[model samples]
Target: MSWKDEIEQLRKRQALAKGMGGPEKLKRQREAGRLNVRERLDLLLDSGSFREVGSITGRAEYDDAGNLIDFTPANCLFGRGKIEGRTIAVVADDFTVRGGAADAAIIEKQIQAEKMAGELRLPLIRLIEGTGGGGSVKSILDMGATYIPFNPGWDQVVANLERVPVVSLLLGPVAGLGAARAVSSHYSVMVKGSSQMFIAGPPVVAGIGEQVTKEELGGADLQLAAGAVDDAYASEADAMAAAKWFLSYLPNSIHDLPERRETTESPGRRDPALGDIVPRDKRYAYDMHQILRSVTDEGSLFEMGRNFGQSVITAFARLDGWPVAVLASNPKVYGGGWTAEAAQKITRFVDLAETFRLPVVHLVDVPGFVIGTRAERAGTLRHGARALSAIYQASVPWCTIVIRKAFGVAGAAMMDHTRFRYRYAWPSGDWGSLPLEGGVEAAFKAALAGADDPDAMKDDLNRQMKSFSSPFKTAERFWAEEIINPAETREKLTEFANLAAPLREPRTKAPRYRP
Candidate 1:
């Protein structure tokens, strides 16, 4: 063939692949108020920065003259692109074609995309929807045979988790392997009304004699509350923006480190309100969110697992524009005691921070792990120990500011216990093996039972114990770190962040995750 003829053939093939599924299917995507796969890329990436990887791949129908008659592209689309001046990889599912099912070269392309991201040490943004290259009924009919359920690229998928920063956006109904991919990323988002995720869709559930609608099975509200996904946005555009913002806080890969940026607030900035942030009366509950906002840079707290672990708040925040993981105990829930679910949440959050080499800050108020029949049934101790193990295994710098009560084993798990002299307690802090109120009842039970004025005796002992257990007494022994003014938290934490910045080893080791 002449050069001119070959060029004409190339143009024809490019036109076929670029056409996507066709106008009719694409119109349906628009009618549903969602952007198509190609359109999503345009919105997500810097304009004209996306470089195609497998644009010529698809199922091509050839005529007798060896001329192409039809073409159906792979449901998976991928390539390198720039987001906010940072280079990264993007993989999106083309639901218009085969519902992103097992067809053509989608399975291979999807697997390759994961491998490429890891190899290039780039961040990966997954625009997930449909089946995520899962089994399709039509595929079996076309092949005249059935195959056992399996995920071909799962190994690469799993490897990518530790190698790169991954963000998944659920733009449509995700099922089976699709759901797994959507949830596997470090950060994930879903469109509030349009996105749903499930291990199996309604039709698959019907085969097992169960009846349920798609929304009822795995709606964003249920999934977010259950801690299956990190967040949900009102639109795909918003979700994309969130994904971009998340990447801004993280490095392109585990091999690199997150750079600090300038913020509107100075490092030494302090709010006078934090002086009275905690009430002297231990019985009253204060809003932990207020403390989080006051200490961290303005609008930099990205909270995770807020619903599943109400007792503990795990969030990503910035101190002097340096990213740090913040864990604060909320007294309103179980008296800030750690539950099994809350412990698991801590393990996961710690892993993210450590993997990205971020420092950690603990706003301590824990009384202990949740205690009761319910807690025992939930294996609270087992999960609590795992959460502790995760903290101990982390190599990043850690600091703790004791805001209130910190009692028993759960208190010990608050920070890197090995980082001696690193703990900081507040003036209102009260920590011991057990709170004075509870200790008096247990220790003076015999004395109280025999005393004529049992109630008075109990009250007197509690008062004495509370006075003896003051933070000053512990500081006198040089056991706990200095007890500072509550309002000084931001200034101290910002200084600590500055001190820890140079201590982190290059490409710091990833976190030890609790199962």
Candidate 2:
């Protein structure tokens, strides 16, 4: 064909693809307040910066007369884009095409995208919705007699997860494989009323004896509470905004450290409330989050697992422009006690920060593990041990600030004095193998039993033990490195972060991280 004739044919094809679903569907989507896959890409990426791949790929289907029904790109969209000036790889599913079903070519597209992100060391963001590339009954006919039971691309996906930051956004109904993709991310977000995620849809679930609405079973509230998703938003725009905010703190690749922005805020800036956030009495409880908010850079704390593991707080925050992961005990819940659930949450979080080479700041206020029949039944020992293992395996710089009671195995697990790079205790901090109250009862049982006034004698013994159990006593013994004023915490942490920044040690011969 002549060059002029070819150009006219190409334009006609492009026009037809652009009008695939016609105007009614476009108008309905506009009225419903949800952005389509292409629109979402535009909103997420820098203006005119997205370079699309596989735009002309689609289903290979035939009519009764054997005529082909060619369409635009396949349901999946893969591209390279810039978010807030930082380059990233994006894979978005077009729900308009066969509900974004899994096909051989589309699966190859996803695998290639993941491989590109890993090999190039770029962070990947998946705009997941619909079926999420799961197997369909129609696959039986497509594969004929010789078929592989499992997709090979899953391995690449898993490999990319450990190498770079993976973010997934649930913009619509995510089922089966789709839900897995969402949770497999280092971070995930869901739009409140619009998104629902589940292993199986309501139709499949109904056959198993229970009939429930999608939202009731796998709603944003349910997933957030279960720690399956990191955050939920009221709208798609909010979800995209959050994704941008999250990527701002992470590096584009493992070869580079996260970039820091210049800030007018000083590292020594302190909130007055830190001085008295914790009460002097051991029995009193206070919100550790309040203390964290006061000490870290103002308006910089981005919390993770907020609903699950309520006793502990894990978040990313900036101290004068440097990113650090803050792990604090929330005394408001269970008196800052650690449970099996809390232990699992902490382990996962610490591993993530270590993978990304982020420094850790521990705000210690642990009393002990939650002890009861329920705790024992829940395999608390095994889970708590996992948390300890993760902390021990961490290679990144760690610093702990003992805010209050740091007692028993839980305290030791928070930040081991022997292994941690830097450790500081506040004046009000207290540390022991066990709290003095329980120890006094166990050690002075005989003495109190023989006394004329057992109650009075027990009270006296408790007071005596409390006096020697103060944080200053530990400082005197050189168990705690130094005791600092509450106001100096931000400055001290920032100095330590700078000191630790230059201390980089790569894993030379270590085995792959498990769990």
Q: Which candidate comes out best when scored by lDDT? A: 1
CA lDDT of each prediction against the hidden true structure = 0.86, 0.80
Model 1, 38: alpha-carbon shift in Å?
A: 0.9
lDDT of 2 by residue, 113-191 (tens): 8888988889999999777555566765776654655644777677766777888999888997777778888889999
Task: Supply candidate 1's per-residue lDDT for 311.
Answer: 96
Clashing pairs in 1: none
Give the lDDT of residue 9 in candidate 1: 82
Q: Candidate 1: where is the Cα deviation over 4 Å?
A: 508-515
What TM-score goes with each of the models? 0.96, 0.93
Q: What's the residue-level lDDT of 326 in candidate 1? A: 91
> Looking at candidate 1, what is the lDDT of residue 70?
91
Candidate 2 runs further than 4 Å off: 15-33, 60-72, 103-105, 138-148, 505-515
Question: 8, model 2: CA deviation in Å?
Answer: 4.0
- Residue 19, model 2: lDDT of 54
Worst lDDT 10-window in candidate 1: 506-515
The sequence of per-residue lDDT tens digits that candidate 1 reaches over residues 373-433 is 9999999999999889888888788989999888999998878766654778888888888
